[model samples]
Target: MRNTSDISISVVVSCTAQTAALLPWTLKAVMAQTSPSHDIIVVENSAVPELPSMPAREARRLRLLHLPGAARPALRNAGLAAAQGVLVAFCDSGDLWKPSYLAIMREMWRVEPRLLLAYGDAVPLQGDTWGTERGFANAPTGFWDGQRSLGPLLSVFDQPPMPRLLEFQPFLPSGLVAQRGFLERVGGWDTACTLLPGHDFATALRLARHALFGIMQRAMVGVRPEADGPAHAQAVNMGEARILERALARDETLWSQAQVIRAAIVRRRQAALAIAFARGDLAAVQEIAALLPQQERSSPTLLKLGLAALPAPLRRAGSAALFGLGASRTSLRWPGN
Candidate 1:
């Protein structure tokens, strides 16, 4: 068992100057930690102006690594290497961790020293919410939904229903804290998904090989899902997947997981399309849906088609009835209604 006393944790948060506004909430949450990380590395990826003028003394122990060429995986890898702690947690620019976020992770790790990768329920920030109404909402529309289409991709030993992955689009980047050794074993965040789309899914698929993980029933982090520049991110994410597949070319064992990975990717792509359609952006819905592999596009398109086929009166009727249904629902169980 790794001695907790020797454990130092690193929380990686990155932002360009353009997004610096989002990092403060994250920094605030980290500073609020009752169980302080041994080291907190905030990788400033912004080119124009770096992190805000906030004093370093605001947080107990903090270090800022300024990387102008930073991408998500590069920042994560740098933070991981720079991390003096045995455990590492991630909080992105627009996210906020719950008070006990780090503490709960510390306790869980302390209890099971062998545990490698662990993640839990994430409270979605509407900006980032991609699917699921209970996930995060903006007025009449849900920016993100908890529904996951590819549920089977999650590989924890006591895994959730594979189907649930379909509704909630399992494996969020914001709600995870993992051991450095385990991360090293799995090769850190695959820069492949570093873009926008499959990074989380690819990370989940690759990281699962390292352990039988646990799911914290309570939400500990707020994840904003709005991806303003998804095209570029998706392109990068796909490139990373290809890179990862190449890296694993010789390993049949890990390659075995590719099918699950593929399924998860398909679900992820579909979920985004679902949300795009709901947003009433027919062009975006068409563009993204067409990007899906032909065979894979069928179900989601059919689902969209089915939804589009709905009589306007009936759709409006359901919406009217649901107006009374409220905005959010909480469940650690499968999120589908």
Candidate 2:
């Protein structure tokens, strides 16, 4: 293997006002890496560009790019443009990296010079507590089983099927590291996809088309939980549907599975509609319902439509009683509902 010292890495962190408080912990993790990065860039996208103070020694290699009020994709793109390393890694404001994270990634790149994109598993952090499940556990069954092992801890997806990626996206930006040249070749982040929940997933889909992808089986990153609520769920569903639509439009390979993709899109919209209905957002409910296929005469579709037609107050009450206005409001119970 090539010398690890020869590999240069830049870490890009995306932050907003809401997540700025956790930035110190994130910076601490980055600074503590066994294989230190060439530089650390934090892109602050908020109304006011501000960051917590750091010691002179720690701040020397750290730079702040203040893109006030910019969207996530734009923030990341800005960081990518300013990065001056051979490999670029991304982290969210509240996420963390284990001390060995960069060392492991550098070793993997040294061993496999063809790797364009690689990601590892991240353990979810809820407040100060860590979750037992790693991020890869969320991947669909048998998804990783087909990968060819580069080593005991490394697996490469040799020409992964596009359908599988579309079906269940398992990539997270926080866990990803990519070659700077390959990232630029793929056009970096899609600035057009601003404010979308799964823009990173969408970008990964684009990269997966031609890049050599790899997975580190070990969990080397920590992911903090995002806001939880029905509105958040609704936005996620809508964003996912949009991503599927864009993929179907551009990729002819997915044309064969148009029906499957369409069905998936409808399922997402239906979930969004359900959330809208539960939250008493009648306008959103009707708007989302209109996008669903007219041929969907399923009982759930009929029931949702019928409920949507009733008086606003009655509809809200009925939705709460049926779906239980708690955690279940995020998704419908019945399949295809």
Candidate 3:
């Protein structure tokens, strides 16, 4: 392994046909890293041809790999094999980075050689709902448009993490850099996690427990969110469920911990569905209702709210059945009716 001060990070960015709109933004951001030594890896999992950076542009070590799946954890593993850098940073295609991203992360690792992973804040962009980064400093509300509530959980060596990996991941994948040796030591993403909520979070969780890690309180990237994007949520849920299931099967030793995390995530997802229902989001409600197994959904808070509004007898009966909400009745139970 190379020393942190001398480390060159191999940055891996994920892309698909659907995320093409973000290529210019994401790659340019990664390319803009302060430290000139970092290399960029663009993994194209979509059927679309590789992104067009003019032939006139130069990337001495820039490379692109075709992975053929949106879930390119496998491709990431391959990148690990091909990487010449001492560290690896994961970037998502639809995200942008702060100018000092690579430099700051490298400095942090160099300062603390035992640190296994390090990451910071991510600012998200939802279409048509925000402003250009210009004049961001003077905004009274704050420069960040939508700051997630759970960014701080993963910045530690020990703490009771929020239950769901998706809801409060200690480390958001984008902007996170890990020592190449640690990644190889722990083994890469759990391939068995065909789909699960926190590939990044889960990996970090495992690493934090087993290795020394570090955190920097700085803003590092821009994540894009689609306005009321239903399919995205569905994919998110599908991905989480699959990942959690895989986590359980992958490490029998961690099955107990995985169960705790999955239960919390399940409840979180169920609450999301109920919120969509109460807000009369027929599509989101239906999608959330249909995205997983019957025994897998719940909205205890919503159920309690519903029960609170009802006579005790009806509340008891209704609550007992969970309003019979599941894939079969999803279409039948939209909020309006």
Candidate 4:
């Protein structure tokens, strides 16, 4: 195991002009870290680059990179390339970090020298309020036991006896800290996944194939809720589907797990279809439904597809009833349900 006494960390904060206002709070949190990073890099992808004013002490470690109109994946890759620390951490301008976050990560590396990637849990934040739901609330049961520890990282290619890391997305970018070398070895973020919401998940999925992972069970970061509404949800589902498909094509070894990957793709499409149905988006519902195989399409799914052709008023009423019923029957509910 390498000596951890000289660990240096660099934080990458990615933002756009739209989120510039939240940068100050994010930087403030970073500056307050118990174990400060070697540097803080802000990568902004906006037409007009604007930054929050930092005090001299904080400003000394700050560097700004302008990637005009670059997407999140591109901005993050640039940050990875520019980071000078052995360890690199990521946070969005709208997110917050607990003071002990870096300290906990440093200790994790100290204790487990082989750890390639480690992430903490995050609480949901909306403006000034912190939501009770944790970022991993939607993850598979028993996957994260709310304890700080290191463990083997499993991938979708793993068989049933092992918990597949990609079974459900668990890592939040803001809560993640990874070895710089591991990230570079994986070729950084997926630039092709531009405009996709799950680029972080894609990165994590790739890394899972190469190394062991650690988790700090505590909520050490604050994450703003993703934009609500059907369109955003549909986009997320589509992005996840694309990531899974790309994964399958790139690695023939994964073909052994083809059934699992295909099932996950179908689920993402079904989720997109459900979101469209709930929002009474008939066109989207039909579009997503057509992507599903006939065998995978259930009777209720067909009913919803047929209802999409009805008059707007009738369609909306049917949608509302179906949505409410589905919600009520859902066994796996996130916080605030």
Candidate 5:
């Protein structure tokens, strides 16, 4: 590891054969960073390497580290182990970072040496259209909008009457940059979370306990749409709930704060169940429903569940009227423009 004074960053990118088509764009975006990188380590997680050739400029900063036949979380763990810079950032093959991402992170760390990590908003992309992800959509106006003064650093645990945490999405790995020491001290990603799929959340919770967090005002990445279909809905919802459960079990100080977060997640899960019911995905609906509290499985939600059992055409028409197809992904932003 480099000295704490060293500000250079090493970026770990998770890649696989399935994402070959998207890797080039991601790499190009990394090379465009206003703050030049110390290294860009691409961790290939597949039986056979399938990444395309890198351009001369990017190839100079980029190196491929193969962990053939490894899982996604394992690939990230391997890359973290191989990192050599003072600061580390993560990006997935399909996520595109804005040119100013590393530059802003560098500035934030410089302004506050005590800050353990910094993250920015992301404008999500769904197929050909632009979409807003949970973090950006429900972000507390003062923080992300830059009205509140973060001063040197910001920590949810720093003040006495904590800020009313919003029902917003937590920052994902793709948009985060953290101190190398902090990352290592947290024991890197939870390898066991591969089954639960909330490794990022678990890691963030660990970091929040001991260090400060910074929130940048600009959107830093364009999140690629997820490809996993309804078949994995149960796992995804359950994974989020499990992460919160584990956090509450481990930290009593955060109990009150985490309850707000838990409520927000339940709301999102309820919304998700609506989508599943609209599609007549009974199995997914059943699995996800079992994870929520009885009150969350409301009369309206249950009514929708019954409607979904109707004929396909009837269900589609009912769902469109009740849920609005376009509103599903951006429900938090509904009503007007």
Candidate 6:
């Protein structure tokens, strides 16, 4: 394994047909990294024939992999295999990284050479909605404990973290940096987790089970909300649920911790359904609602369903009222209704 002195980072920016427009910005951020020696691999998982040309510096550092119709997780796995750097980092198209992101994470790895992963908070570029990155910043730290650092607010979750310590996913792929060797040892991203809802979280959780990790409280990355952010939320909701269910099944001891997370996911779904109903998007409401298991539906979901059944005009007005008046009183749900 290479030492931090010989630090060379391989940043994997995964792009898709829908995310093509954001690729330039993502690559630009990579060019601005404070670290001196690093390369980038863009795994384009789309049927698009060609990618936009990159700037000279980024072009020099980049190796384009055209998978032409590949799953997200598979794209990541491909990037993982192709990466040659001692340390590896990942971010999606459209997300912007702070200039110091790589520098700080590298410092953390320098401090603890055995670290399997280092991740931090991200600021939401879109509107601050329920369960958004902005909200996560305000939420209390349950699994991760904060630490003081010269650059950012840092935290360290010891290797083999306390059971269920990863119940709440506090990080994203954009915010994480990991050692290549450690990742290889644990096996790369689960290709089966073709859906993200929790692929990033599940991978991190599984790594946390065996390796040391770090976290930064301050936002190190700025994640842009998708064009159809609400629609993406539904996918994420399903993704998280599936990941948790599989995890729980594998280790029943995590049931207590998993239950808290399970309830949270359910509530998020209910909140999303409410938002959809309020926005007068009956179709979206129905679609999101159908995704939830019948047994998991809660009172809030029932209320949202009733609200959605109202006339479109009334539903829109009620949604605005619920979101506006209930801002402080009601627990705001996920983004985009």
Candidate 3 ranges beyond 4 A from true positions:
1-5, 46-51, 54-57, 126-167, 194-204, 226-242, 255-266, 269-273, 276-337
- Residues 31-81, candidate 5: write the lDDT tens digits: 898887899888986633645676676677777888887766677778888
Clashes of each: 34, 0, 7, 0, 0, 0
Candidates sorted by lDDT, best first: 2, 4, 6, 5, 1, 3
**Cand. 6 TM to true fold:** 0.73
Over the stretch 139-201, how does candidate 3's per-residue lDDT look in tens digits? 233213222222332233433222323343435566567888888888875465535533454
Q: How many backbone clashes does candidate 2 have?
A: 0
lDDT of the structure predicted as candidate 1: 0.58
Q: Please, what is the whole-model Cα lDDT of each candidate in the order they appear? A: 0.58, 0.78, 0.57, 0.75, 0.65, 0.66
lDDT of 2 at 319: 66
RMSD of 3: 8.9
List candidate 1 stretches off by more than 4 Å.
Answer: 1-6, 47-60, 126-168, 228-251, 254-337
Model 4 C-alpha lDDT per residue in residues 1-337, reported as the tens digit of each score: 4455588999999886666788889889999998899999899887336567768888899999999888767888789889999999999888899898898788778777677877778887889776777766667776654344343321111212212554567667788788999888878877776667565667767766654666666777898855655566666777788888888888897888888888888887887777766666778878888989999998878988988878888987887778874444323323211
Compare the candidates by lDDT and give the number of the best one. Answer: 2
Ten consecutive residues with minimal summed lDDT in candidate 6?
328-337
TM-score winner: 4
1-337 in candidate 2: lDDT tens per residue?
A: 6788998999999987777889989899999998999999999876336557878887888888988788767888889989999999999888888899999999888888788889888777877676667767677677677777778789787774455665566667788899999899889987766667656667766777764688898988888756556677687778878988988898798788899888878877877887876676767877887888888645665676777788878987766666554236464320011
Candidate 4 minimal-lDDT segment of 10 residues: 154-163
